[model samples]
Target: MSRLDVTTSVPVFTRPLRSTCRGVPASEAPPLSSAASLVGQQVGHFRLLRELGRGSLGVVLLAEHALIQKRVAIQVLHAHVTQDPARVARFLQAARTLTLIQDAHIVSLYDLGMRDGRPFLIMEYLEGQSLAAFAKGPLAPALVVDLLTQVCDALGAAHAHGIAHGSLNPTSIFLVPDAKGRQHVKLLDFGIAGLLPPSEGAADSPVAADLFAVGVLGALLVTGRLPSRGHAAEEPLHGHAWEVPPLPSDLRSALSRVLLKAMARRPVDRYASAAGLRDALHASVALDGGAAPPESLGLERLPGWYALRGPPGVAPASR
Candidate 1:
């Protein structure tokens, strides 16, 4: 089998720092100063517990509110990256947008603050796996539509408010479980997602770009591989040929149509709005009694980060 080729793009916020970030590897970057040693320390009312995720851009930490004992995730910019005024403005805007946009499917920003010349955002901490965890496997048809519907709802809400999640990928789409074990979908990393740049055609519209991303995400869920990386002109006008386990004949046509249209190369050919795409997803779900909500269905247990234990907060258990 040909190794499936998947196209990936860096988050818009990180693109500007590519040269500098690449030049100064994490090891070469100066160590966190004593004042920057946040663990077991309090920032405002939140007590930093331990690190959750770290990257060139920032570090995500698990923190607890001192007064309420509520837990949240806090992302602190790397010390060196804080020197760039433009980058800092964009970073702060990212957090502001999250705080402004309210949706159950989107991660919520609780607060923002400056610490030792660096900025940090307090956000809802999730106990689950990113969709990236499932990128290699075929998902039940119902679950695909469910994730699609919820994500569309989230995109639509953000679009309505003039925010565009410039970056949408498996890693940013999280599958969070509720107390009852039913998994709910939530979007993360909106801080760097900004409006799309204007282009010659409708395809350049932010909404179109978002829908295109959704189409790609759907393709990943069903086929376990991204649509071939190339311009629409390079592939078939409708949809790229998918190489994955075949689906039931009963719903294959509808599924194919949705994927192709959502991923249409030209923005004009794609769904006009996230809500429109969601409605189409609902129509598809109607074909089969609909897949159980992600939370209700017992998906193969998520591995990696989802199974790892964090500090003394909510730990995700394998099913």
Candidate 2:
């Protein structure tokens, strides 16, 4: 994502390479210290504060700018992965893609560099948990609808730029809360998702893949559990089903129709684009206002009451 002009009142500094490993015996490097030695050290212009989390290929740290105290998230690629040329190229490309996108809903990439031969990414520090945190229960109808709309906007922007968010899981969708009680959605890890090649077929296109994932997310948000097979209650979600919990009477029918179509097994069956989905959702939200029938129903009603007025510059015909 591109950087917005939101002021944090902090002076931005160009991060310098100040590895904590300096002056330490080669045998006692951070690699030997479980990589925790990075804590309390300055990498680039940011001071590594603590380990936020560690994934298969990277370690994310809560970092602070030394001079301005602005907080940021730094993700350092593991040494093993850094050795792979293809992987490193993909990682760098992902960062470039985010920088080019600049979507408000996507996580912003602020900087990129290498430290001791390991590549790292600097990004906006978003405070909140992933959608995974709410996997225990379903969200209310209004809440899910609101979230889905925002995500669609982000996805639409990415699609427009020819970027494909290959992986669209709950863990990657962060829900950040602002000063107000309203929650804001930030799509994360675009680079990680970019490692995969674009799949073939319309159903397998990048846009279609993202929409399919969003459909799964919608189901998860509404049901708390994914559509499941006949398995033990303790097992995680295994199969794909459009099953969602019964929502309020007012929202049930419309929302169900929208989500089911999104989760369609065929790409052609789903919305042609994220914008299409957004329009459909907008209509659904206003369905109670007595608007026209949903486009999903393939209903097209011609005007039943056309004006009988004569052509311009001509007098009206007498009844």
Candidate 3:
């Protein structure tokens, strides 16, 4: 069980500050202030409760509906970020893209509005740790496959809508427990990554890039390490190549082949779609004594597994 060093270039949004707002339209509100002042304030039909986390671009607040009392997460853009009209346009476009996608494995959007000239998004609040927290060591083969399958289902739904996640890292993959205490996947920050400038030498097609990320995640879970690190260089494949290590001894060789194909540097060499990767996983499971029974998967046995109540006294992390 070696430790995994997961990293991502994806931009993250979290934190809190304060500002004031009345009935002023988002376009008419004055220059923004710290979001911390927003606690106990009203934004749209929800009241800000407390700060969950803040990022370079925005702040995430735990909010509750005034009437229904239903709790939700609210993400508000920072004043500096709002100053760029192009950035603001991208943010609004991302929101629209999110509305077009509806899947249980992906976080749900409830509403979109403005607060003191800053754009805000109302989203479903989830209670669970991210996949990043549990990636400290190699996970059980069954658990890895289960998680991969769920993520594939989510990406499949998004792809069908002609959208790409853009950012598919461990932190974006949330794990919420059901009434049966089974950990289910819920993807966060779907189109937000498109808001940032494209990285140099980045993948040409967002869809192909997403599949590549899925392969990276798969390799990390199986080996507790990224395939791109600490290996001898080899001839590049399709102008790029990652030095993937062999799968653990306990895993079937067929599983190794599946991961390799998914990770192929050439977009054309990889699985055509998320569905293709998922079907490969299913076939591998069928050949290896059937998928492990859900009850026997034992995700609760992981080092930092959390229940629906979540860790005591700890506020849930921002999405």
Better of 2 and 3 by lDDT: 3
Q: Report residue 204 deviation for candidate 1 (angstroms).
A: 2.2
In model 1, the number of clashes is 3
Error of 1 at 93 (Å): 2.1
The CA root-mean-square deviation of candidate 2, after full C-alpha superposition on the true structure, stands at 14.4
Q: Give me the candidate number with maximum TM-score.
A: 3
- In candidate 1, which residue pairs get closer than 3 Å at backbone N, Cα or C atoms, i.e. clash? 94-191, 182-295, 183-295
Candidate 2 lands at a TM-score of 0.71
Q: Of the candidates numbered 2 and 3, which has the greater TM-score value?
A: 3
Give the per-residue lDDT of model 3 (tens digit) for 135-212. Answer: 556665667777888988888888887777776665667666566555677677665565555644455477777777
lDDT of 2 by residue, 240-288 (tens): 3233345334446777778878877787898878888877766676763
CA deviation > 4 Å runs, candidate 2: 1-34, 196-203, 226-251, 288-319
Name the lDDT of candidate 1. Answer: 0.56
**Each prediction's Cα lDDT score?**
0.56, 0.56, 0.61
Ranking by TM-score: 3, 2, 1
Taking the candidates one at a time, how many backbone clashes does each contain? Answer: 3, 5, 13
